[model samples]
Target chain A: MSERINSAWSPSSREKERAQARKRISRKQAVVAAVSSIIVIGSLLTIVVTSPGWAVVKKTFFDINYGREVFPTVISGLWINLQLTFIGGACIGVIALGLALMRTTKSPALTPFRFLATAYVDIFRGAPLILIILLVGFGVPALRLHGISSNVIFLGTVAVVLTYSAYVAEVIRSGILSIHPSQRAAARSLGLTSGQTMRYVVLPQAIRRVVPPLLNDFVSLLKDTGLVSILGVTDAVRAAQINASRTFNYTPYVVAAILFLLITIPMTRYTDRAIRQRTNAQNAEGAI
Target chain B: MSYVLELSHIRKSFGNELVLNDLSLSVQEHTATVLIGASGSGKSTLLRCINLLESIDDGQIFLDGVEISDPLINVDEVRRKLGMVFQSFNLFPHKTVLENITLAPIKVQLKSKEEAVDAAMTLLKRFDLADKADQYPDRLSGGQQQRVAIIRSLAINPRLLLLDEITSALDPVLVNEVLSIVRDLKSDGMTMVLATHEMGFATQVADEVCFLESGNILERGTAQEVLHNPKNLKTQDFLKRVHQAGRL
Candidate 1:
């Protein structure tokens, strides 16, 4: 109490933190400025190119304004990519949680179960994913093991789900172990059943700590979904490639690149903010 | 006299090293007994065995005239009747003070949440932490949190309350707060068994004080007899060191 009184400065002498915070430009203005800078830099290049009569340089991004003919296909392609990512990422998350629990359970009787899950992870993560896609897409029907038929898109979906869940499992295992043993003890001491303690006490804190890392995994899973298009899934990336090949125009590749950015850019920004906020919390705790 | 709890010839060994060897004591109903000893003297372990927090390899523990250490005894039922507070003030960090107090009553006892909260509120108010009802354990002072832990145990309305060095973790200034709450508990006719190094707490609140060395109860009697004129040389030496430490 005495220390606080001594540390306090005169009202007029203190700097206004809010006023200082207000001095930085807003995010909207920063984006506006960046876009304008790109335009200015492009026009400078165009001016230099046309003056020199360089044929290849003459069609700078500024001089060549390809009309809005490509807009509809590009927009649809981005929408398809977004939908694919959400579906694939959700499947990976749901499967990863079960596998992570399998990896950590200690019962010797459940050893077979644990080994099977581990083998699944090791095989998918170790092999080339492209081969796994072809094997699932082609081999299943040829084997005639059951009534299953050849479904390329279904097989592609299965391949992506299998590949990403292993990495997600590791992410989840770290989350569960990060909780203090005392937290679980406290729950057990209250006479809560083992499962009840896990569900109510342990998982809540562990899941909170893992959210940012899980978000990172989810975003990565979304990006990996584009690989599925190679297995004839007709996803955004595949559609763009088909159009590009047919017309022999480079526009489709550019369109696909934009499609990727549309999904990845916002996802990256959200996870970045969430992770930074958590990191800053850790730093504050260290300061204390 | 009908005793609330009796541990006879209790022997516990963790591998080769014996933590408690033939330790025995009887606790009377509504009486406060304090166990005093140096570090690693098995005083805490002996107290923990009564509540079955730690199992005893040999010997018998009887609670309320019923043998509790028997193979047929249901430990969960025994634990419901026994409440323990730790030196570390093991308040659930994620829970509020009131919720920590109310959790076991609702969860284990199957009492309605409203009924449990009412019982918890009384303990919180008695501990002068009613205002801290919604505050997390980490937000409270060490003394306040320890008191909350004590109140949390008390809310369960245990027939026997075991306090294992409850005030040792508190600051010097905060020690008195916890001790006074313990003293108040005794005055209110609560039956409690405590393990403490503070000779003065033993003198002020305990009806019987036991001097422990290694795993044996070296001496036990009325607080006045043990505190003022102990017969054992070890007891005298232990109290002398306690006094010197307090002075320092």
Candidate 2:
């Protein structure tokens, strides 16, 4: 009986043949993938390089020396974009959390605030980001508010924070709503006050569920900070605009685009990984 | 004697569907009261009403002889003295077993973190769940999760514990583990009101068994009197059906 059990557990010659067949199929698949990718990408590259205006296009957009020369200024300009994103992102997180809580609150004391939050989300989310930036940038300065600085950077940050807060708030609210009501009942039954329940039980879970969406907004916020360049904040896009117009070469524009991609692509990959990890965590045993 | 819990003419409705109609019951201190009936028989609603989870449309509830059904009463304050375990074992998925058990003690009762953790560890150890203290609910079997939930409610030292079909969601193999904890709690003299479909378990644990039909307790007696020799026809029919279904 022991011998039979061991034999049953061990891999047989039939199993070895099945494994060999699987390896053969996988090898064939890899070869096919490589051949198709090489053919498609090589043809596209050839078409672009052999175009009639390739010389002019390469000189204007792909000039390595000019790109190297402008890199420092554009990088310094990117420092401003980075500052805007971090500062604006922090402000948006706080404001959006407040808005989401306000919208979801059942307290009669917050009735007016809930109405205001709903209206704010509708207005800002419906309007384009650039339009809000232009309005707040030029409009706030025009109002000549005493305490508020007329600095385009400050004004631009405010506009970005305001618009992004609305979008992020909706994402957060959806997460809150997605949680089963039974969770709230359990918390409440434990004698946690409604506010405590929201703080301890609901918000922690809600915010966790919305992290990937929040990261997506963060990436968009980084790119949209370039929109502040319109207000003459000298961010990466504006710096590229200044350099490109000065030489009329357009290589600086390409350089700035590449810089933005350098940051965004990794963030996008991280967001995808976060989403996959969350899905796996949900399905995996002992997941925290 | 002042009762641990009392419901007088409690009436509740959800959008024209009457769930509990003029229902009333009382529980004595340190006694286990078991409610048994078929589905939609108002056993769960009565328990919910006692815990103040469901607002009474018209009635009075007295917890330890205080009229808690008054509209001006703070429901949260009342809930602090009562513990409830649900049919689905609604353990907070985000929290570890120990954290789930300690949450109410730390937050609601305002116990020191060390004190709550000590109490939680004691309960978990006693329940054979000390090893699962750091595991999330999804990592544990349904029985283990339900045991943790019972421990969570006990951490607050509630005067009255309300259990709404606590073992209804567990598999047959898992039900005994969960029911055994309640058996232990009964022997330890915990005041409890539970609705269940387990007739054999009810006979073992209940000091009093109430048979509910629609929204009324049609029969009330000791489990031997109620389960084995029910007087009301509805109670007998319900028991016969349950027995035929192999649940009794």
Candidate 3:
């Protein structure tokens, strides 16, 4: 009887035929997908190459020599954008966390601060990023405030931090509010102080839930750093602008765009994968 | 003997709906006091009030003869001496079983990390859950999670344990495994107050049984007195319904 049970559990000859049929279907699906993708992309490429103005467009935008000549300068300018992103990102994280906590706190002592935090988020999040950058870049130095550096980079970074902090704070606040009240109840009942509960139980879970959104904000922040080029910070976009105007060729602009995509595409893929993994983890039985 | 826990004229309400109204009870140390009632009869609220999870609208709660209901009393201090288990098994999903058990000990009780982990391991091993120590709460079956919750409560060596319909959310087959741990705690003379629908288990464990109806304890006596022979009409009616449901 045991031997018969073992045989029953093992794959049968019929099962092998079913498996082969499934493999055949999957292989057919892959071939169809590849053929359709090629047909669509190939047609689009043909249309572009056969356009009436294709010669002028290619000469201006796709000049390999011009692209390579501006590569070093564009790459150097990207270093400035990278610096602003890391420094501005760190500042935004700390300030946003404080704002989120202030908004979420139920303490009567923090009531006025909560009101202030809400007003801050409303003002910054509502105003346009470029407007904020322009105002801060040109306006702050006009104040003639002591100990304030009127450096365009400093002003641009400050403006980015202010606006992004508001947006990121809202994302974090939503994550915090998404946690069930029962979790707080459980922690509090276990004798954890309200502050301890927030620090130990709520924040860890909230931060984890918002990582994908946070990464999306990071990508936006990186792109928005280019807007600071208007303040003459010599970032990638500004460097490309200088080169493009000098030669009357758009190859440098294309080069800068490609460089930006090189960084962002990998980041976007990582964010997508993170979101998929989180969804799968949530749906899987016995997942942690 | 002085009671381990005493409540007098406890009143609570949510909006216009009064959940517990002038309810009063006392629990002797090392005794299991089982509260049997219909849904929305204030059994869970009563336990919550004792644990200081809910503030009483009126009246007083005395834990070890101290007036914990006083406005100036530190609630966290009161909660440290009491353990509570919820019906939903409110285990922290982010923490491992061992971390769940040790969190309050290390953070609230100020025990060293090694000391708390050692104590948590002892409780886990005794409860037959040592292997699951590193597993998150979601990875465990309902029975295992509830057992770990019980162990978490026990790790603090609470003066009184409040169980609010703990097995109500469990599957019928899994309910016995969770109840058996409570039975073990009972035999070991842990002072306990439990709200449960399991009358048979109540009969085995309860030193005293209280039948609550509409936010009032309508009758109180031994399990046989309350279950087999009730004096109050409401008690008899509720038990008859429980009997018809095959739960008594």
True-structure lDDT of candidate 3: 0.93
Query: Could you tell me how far off, in angstroms, the CA of residue A244 lies in candidate 1 after the best superposition?
Result: 4.1
For candidate 3 chain A, which ten residues in a row score worst on lDDT? A1-10
Error of 1 at A40 (Å): 21
Across residues A18-70, which tens digit of lDDT does each residue of candidate 1 receive? Answer: 54555555766888999999999999977876675565433322132331445
lDDT of 3 at A28: 100
TM per prediction: 0.79, 0.95, 0.94
Find the candidate with the highest lDDT and give its number.
3
Q: Which ten residues in a row have the lowest lDDT in candidate 1 chain B?
A: B239-248
lDDT of 2 by residue, B135-230 (tens): 989978889989999999999999999999999988999999999999999989999999999999999999999988879889999999999998
What local lDDT does model 3 show for residue B92? 83
Worst 10-residue lDDT window for candidate 3 chain B reads: B47-56
Whole-model Cα lDDT per candidate?
0.78, 0.92, 0.93
Chain A TM-score, candidate 2? 0.94
What's model 3's lDDT at A219?
Answer: 93
Candidate 3 regions exceeding 4 Å error are: A1-10, A285-288
- CAPRI band of model 1? acceptable
Clash number for every model?
Answer: 0, 0, 0
